[model samples]
Target: MYTDALRAEWTKLRTSPGALWSVVALAVAIAGLSALAVAPVTCPCATDTTKLTLTGVQLGQAVAAVVAVMLLGGEYGTRMITVTLAALPSRTSMLAAKATLVGGLVAVAGTVGVGGAWVAGQAALGDELGAGAVWRPLVGSVLYLVLIALFGLGVAAITRNSAAAVGVVLGLLYVAPLVTAMVQDDDWQERLQRFGPADAGLAVQATINLDDLAISPWRGLGVLALWTLSALLLGGVLLHRRDA
Candidate 1:
């Protein structure tokens, strides 16, 4: 039954034109932005090359969020969720199927985007990137985007509204970082930077200046994972309790 539900969700996503295009857009945006960021670096000393090369993840995540939201929220908007629920019966399995599909799709797109960004960086920056520098950001960037997409799916499941879910996820990703920057207290600023979803998650891209970061790379990614998990848990509870 669970496998069947997964197949149904996968099939739905495969058939949706918007979902298909959004995945492509995610890859393109990440690669393009990373290349653009790399092209401007005349002095590598002024920038963290690893972070610069993977900068596309910042913008690419927005598209991932949109794709996740639309996958479930589109069904709600079109009154298709009711039919989905009727067919699946078990809301838990249905939500799990959706999350699994969203996570898998985002992972594939992220791998392409991150791989493209690394190739672009190598072309623009040459041998500046060391052997130790390559693997973490490359692997972490892929995980970062997958987590962001799951975060979106969780939010959409809770809200059951595409527009609201998109807005909240964007604000969490983009605006929270800005608000964290504006804090007068250095301690609070540092704390927020350590925990804020975008700030913490993006820390995974920093190959150099590890001591200067507010949080460790893996730990920062952990913060984002916590946020994603919390949202999904709340969403699952609400999804189980509420009607379609």
Candidate 2:
């Protein structure tokens, strides 16, 4: 039954006109923009190298979010969710199927995009970065993309409106960093950085100057995981309790 539901969701995604473009865009945006961001740097720019690779992620995540939001939010908007629920009967199972598909697609896109960014960054640089140091960041980057998509899915489940969910997701993801940046206290700023999804999740990309960072790499990712899990659990509860 679960396998059948998964197949159905995949069919819907493949048939969606703009869905292909969004996945492509997610990859292109990450790799393309990261290359551009890191193009003019030299060897000593190690920290900058890792940081700039994230330009793609910052932009690509928005595309990823839209892909997830449209899965359920778009259905809600068109009242197609009723048809879906009637067909499936178990909202939890349906959500699990969709979530699995979203994570799988995002993981593939992220791997390609991160690989592209790694090549582009190396080509644009004056020298090679240590492969040993970069591998963790690369792996972490792909996982980060998957988490971001799931985060968007949870928000979409809660909002149940594509327009509103997209707006809220983009606003929080983009604006929260700015709000964190505008703070006057360095200590407080660092504290907030440890909690901000964008900041902490991206911390896993750090290869140099680890001691100076607000949070350690793995722990930062754990923080984002907490945020993602909370969103999913809350969304699941709402999906179970609320009227379709």
Candidate 3:
């Protein structure tokens, strides 16, 4: 049953032209932005090269969120979610299948984007590429994109509206960081940076200054995972209890 559910979700995604193009757009946005970021750097020493190379993730995540939100929210918007629930019957299996399929697609696109960014960085940065730099941020960046996609899926499931879901996810990713910067107290600012979804998640990209970061790379990722999982769980509970 689970396997069939997964296959059905995959079929729906592949057949949707918007979903297909969104993945391509995501890859292009990430790689292109990373290349642009690398091109301006005359001195690699002045910046965290790994983070700069993966800078595209900031924009790419927005695209990922849109795709994920549309996966479910589009159905809701069209009132097709009723048909979907009627077909699947089990809300848990259905939601899980959607999450899995969306996560898989985002992971593939992220791999391409992050891998391209690394190759671009290597070409542009040349000898400045640290021996330890490529692997962690490369892998972490991919995971970051995947998590952002799942995060979007969860939020969309809760809101059940494409526009609202997109707005909420974008605010979480972009606005939270700016809000963190506006805090008057340094300690509170640091705390916000450590806990804020975007700031904490992007911490995985820091290869140069581990000690200076408010949260360690893995722990920062953990903070994001908590946020993602909480959203998913809340969505799941509401989905189970509510009428389609």
Model 3 steric clash total = 0
Q: Where does model 1 exceed 4 Å of error? A: none
Scored by CA lDDT, what does every candidate get?
A: 0.91, 0.85, 0.89
lDDT score, candidate 2, position 32: 94
If the candidates were sorted by their lDDT against the true structure, best first, what order would they fall in?
Answer: 1, 3, 2
Judge candidate 3 against the unseen true structure and give its global Cα lDDT, from 0 to 1: 0.89
Q: Model 1, 33: alpha-carbon shift in Å?
A: 0.7
- Clashing residue pairs, backbone N/CA/C < 3 A, model 1: none
lDDT (10s digit) by residue, model 2, range 1-244:
6887898898999998798788988899899998988877666644556656666888888888889889889999999999888888788888889899999999999899988888887787645554336777988888988988888899899999989888877876889889999999999999999999888888888887889999998898888888888878888889989988
lDDT of 2 at 28: 92
Model 2's lDDT to the true fold? 0.85
Q: Each candidate: how many clashes? A: 0, 1, 0
Error of 2 at 96 (Å): 0.5
Tens-digit lDDT track for model 1 on 39-68? 877654656888888889999999999999
Q: Compared with the true structure, what per-residue lDDT tens digits does model 3 show for residues 46-70?
A: 6787788888999999999999999
Better of 1 and 3 by lDDT: 1
Against the true structure, candidate 1 reaches a TM-score of 0.97
- The C-alpha RMSD of each candidate to the native structure, in angstroms, is 1.1, 1.5, 1.0
lDDT of 3 at 238: 88
Residue ranges of candidate 2 with Cα displaced over 4 Å: none
